[model samples]
Target: MGDRATLFPVKHVIALDVGGTGMKAALVRADGTLLHEDRRATGRERGPEAVVAGILDFADELRVLGERRFGEPALAAGVGVPGVIDEARGVAVFAANLGWRDVPLRALLSARLAGVPVALGHDVRTGGLAEGRIGAGQGTDRFLYLALGTGIAGAIGVGGRIDPGAHGSAGEIGHVVVRPGGPPCGCGQSGCLERLASASAVGQSWATACGDPSADAAACARAVEAGDPRARAVWAEAVAALADGLVTGITLLDPRMLIIGGGLAEAGDTLFTPLRAAVSERITFQHLPDIVPAALGDTAGCLGAGLLAWDLLSTEVSA
Candidate 1:
């Protein structure tokens, strides 16, 4: 009994990462270790109200689990949501994936959790926060974290903080024009970085070139490795566009590191080797930042939410 009691965490926080399709959540100890973790569908097809209700219910379940296991409720909670977020105001300004607009997420979660301090954050920014503090970018003062999944997005970190910018949309690097007059983006921009280099973009390009609708980026990478000329061309084009956008980012941000993650990054050296060479060739006088893969994988956002909750707890104690 004594041993079991001693194993229980003295304090904890709730962390939730809400995405378009699903949510990842955790109960984390003060020292940044997860005590419990869970995943649930977002059910966005049911509408935005249902998604909000789902988040609240999931959070409540986590809190109850924490109390039962640790003998107390969590000290604080943090949520990371996609799209334009007003972290300062705790509002989800707009999220097309979940169809949220001007949702007072933090306040609602706080109330649901019985006044527990709640912190709201942008999803990519929160994930970058985790990568910078405890993952690949740990100990680095400046870095850019890029996720290249179905779409592309970025998080800029400076001095151990994720810059939210004036409007909380500072790191929308995907929208940067890379190949003007090229393919159109959902954002209404033609030849945006994401449209040219994201995983979905690569898949579309490969499918078109190979005349196989089911072909994807990973298959393209495998074909490249196998010395297929068409696959190589497709891969090279995506890499070139990505390098162009990255060069622009490097010139502007001058980060010490560039951490790449997401489904596309799974190509490992097939992506990094060519990407490094391309970025290097484009650099004129800029100091080259170390390009690396993200260490936390899919859990970065949830862990980052934990960090936010911990930060909130610290801020309250100081106050």
Candidate 2:
């Protein structure tokens, strides 16, 4: 290790959002502006080494772009992964989607990127942080951020900060069993909320209701608009299941708001109208929190990773 730590204060940090299908990286300024961005597919089944290599390569590209565009390569980096993580120690404790266990992600990243201080976090939590502080959950102290895409996941935030829980699995609303031995989940559990309320679940349910497994969720929404009985039943089930779990969260945490973010959230009123109605129908005693779509869209996680990098980089620059 070089002994010039004090001399080379990194002015910025690169941020990466690692997902099952792809990873995104960006060089961001202190004001949350991305100066450079890049992405690569995450061939996770190729093994951990290959996935880490791809991330490092993404970092290298960011370094070059940052130096050319922002006058210096980022002094540090922050990565957000979609799974259980020990952010305090920079280790990826588990990634069910990637099949990783006890990976020293921070150490690997630091070594690969040449000793830059790297911060690691749970992707959903970071995305939730972004939404809570700058997007739909902004100005709210306690809120739930839900992502309804290929899989269901959520971020729990209170007072503008996401709480990863003592085990880094605090806001996994999708795993709450709703159907109880109904449909099998990838987690090997039956009738989890994700299998009932996720985007894929929505598509699958509608298809089954129509006796056609090829039904597209979007197309089904269109059919529902035209009063298709099968589409209405499928959509209604998804909404009801979501509301079941949402009510639990609301009763337990009493959050001030709920921010729905992800592919299904993009469905606009098609999803929200029914979901809001379902949740409202179930609530009885407490003041129901506002439900709104995430303002940052799919860019939330990347922006949040950048925000983390920026926080650490600012400390470095000041020191």
Candidate 3:
């Protein structure tokens, strides 16, 4: 057994990104190479305990695979999860979508992996770290990453590192009130940016305008391409509101680049053309930052999880 352990490969780490409905995971080499990738249903419908069990089972399988295939278990592990995270304490405080509350994820993972080091991070911020270090924000010193999905959220990158803020909630631009007294947000704010400009918001607006309850942002983008005036109007409204919110972010962060990602960004130039013009039109004293679409798409979060694992290893080595 000892000789077999010595023969096992020891060059990889496990990275996992747990989402609301699914999970993406990988065995990653130190040079950022993905040796293996896999996906699984999060199975939230089965309840939170089941979800946690599934994650542990999946991770353990990967660890065993590493030992069999590479001759050794993974050196470390990193996991990115949604919701409020106490990163300092390695606890997942609350993830509404996952039905998680105060889950000691790092401790659980460490124990499951035979005492391997583990790092836990917020999903958006982890993705942002990838965007800043290796994705769209690479080569830039400072940037703001906005993900305009079901609900808007942001990440701040400074000097090649993502700033988690003093309270672990730094880049929550979605909660910024863009339209005072316009619409009530779940966060107790009226007319929050996400309520106006998120993909869900666009889908709702388009659904109402087109008289199709199932219409979504993609449908709206297609209609705009087809020159439908109603669709154009709805798209314009979202773009304008997004511009207002982005300008607010720019004035404060002054990022050299603004990296946009998420579902709405799939609209391609349709969203960017109007959004760029609107943001340019709105800025006064703030320097206009270069706006670009996210390059890594859905893979950013998984890759960022790998980075977190590697960072953990590096930190240990240096210490």
Candidate 4:
């Protein structure tokens, strides 16, 4: 390691993206370069309190690392977590996947980081912010970021900002019922888009069909690529449901683009080709936005968190 001291201070911020099982963090410079990056398991199995503590511990470690490397503490910090968030209060309202509820994440992080300002955001929306600002939707004024992961979610982006609706759940396109009498969703709705279209759903469907309970969406995509008829049928169903749900979003938002991300999107053309055709066929009066894959992959969340921290500092300075 280099010397722990430096002659001049380098401006940077700490960024953390917390998922159900993992956390990605970075020390980001003002010009968007990731000066340092790290990852760790969320230790969710240890329970929600432990998860929060782990985040705090991780942030502390990053802070110490940054001070050691750059000779300055992070000016501010930002974190993105999965769940229903009360952004105004910086509270994690509910996160079924992480077993979190009403966690004062911003305050906790700020206190842990010796009062460094903290900005907290929802994970998918935060990722969408990065996608719209610097990734696939870059240069587009309006776009919809759809992540087809373990669950499906949408982030409505406009003018380089994510619209966190009135109740803080604006772009929940996944819960939009596409097939009224279809499979049940964890969100307490039957036939929701995620139930039929998410990566997890696709994998479960494929597993049932192929008689392999351990199979996943990537395996299903591989099978489809190999011309497996059963896999093709399964892929087609998920695409159709996704298209239907997207059409509904298009009808409402009329975004300039649709940026698809998450594990299913890893299939590339296997997911996009038929998806585009199906969406085109279903849309009658709605304009079909250009569909593209997410450019940042898994790093979007951490980048977005950095942006969030930068934005917070900007706001503070402006005020």
The candidate that wins on lDDT is 4
Ranking by lDDT: 4, 1, 3, 2
Query: Scored by CA lDDT, what does every candidate get?
Result: 0.93, 0.83, 0.91, 0.94
Model 1: per-residue Cα lDDT over 1-319, one tens digit each? 2213336456999999999999999988776798888999999999999999999999999988887778788999999999999899999999988998999999999999999999999988899999999999999999999999888899999988899999899989999999999998889989999998999999999999999999999999999999999999999999999999999999999999999998899999999999999999999999999999999999999999999999988888899
Candidate 2 regions off by >4 Å?
A: 1-11, 313-319
lDDT of 2 by residue, 153-192 (tens): 9888887678889877898889999889889887889999
Task: Using lDDT as the measure, name the better of candidate 1 and candidate 4.
Answer: 4
For model 2, the local distance difference test gives 0.83
TM-score of every model?
A: 0.96, 0.91, 0.95, 0.98
Please provide, for model 3 over 1-319, each residue's C-alpha lDDT reduced to its tens digit, 9 standing for 90 to 100: 2324445356999999999998999888877778888899999999888888888898998898778777877999999988888889999998878898988889998999999999998898889989888899999999999999988989999997888898788999999998899889978989999998999999999999999999999999999999999999999999999999999999999999999999999999999999999999999999999999998888888888889999999999999
Considering TM-score, which of the candidate structures 1 and 2 is the better prediction for this target?
1
TM-score-based ranking, best first? 4, 1, 3, 2
TM-score winner: 4
How many backbone overlaps does candidate 1 show? 0
Q: Write the per-residue lDDT of candidate 4 for residues 1-319, one digit (tens) a residue.
A: 4646567777999999999989999999877789888999999999999999999999999999889888889999999999899899999999998998999999999999999999999899999999999899999999999989999998999999999999889889999999998887788889999999999999999999999999999999999999999999999999999999999999999999999999999999999999999999999988889999999999999999999999999999999
Backbone Cα, N, C clashes tallied per candidate:
0, 1, 5, 0
Off by over 4 Å in 3: 1-10
Model 1 TM: 0.96
Mark the regions of model 4 whose C-alpha exceeds 4 Å error after superposition: 1-7
TM-score of 4: 0.98
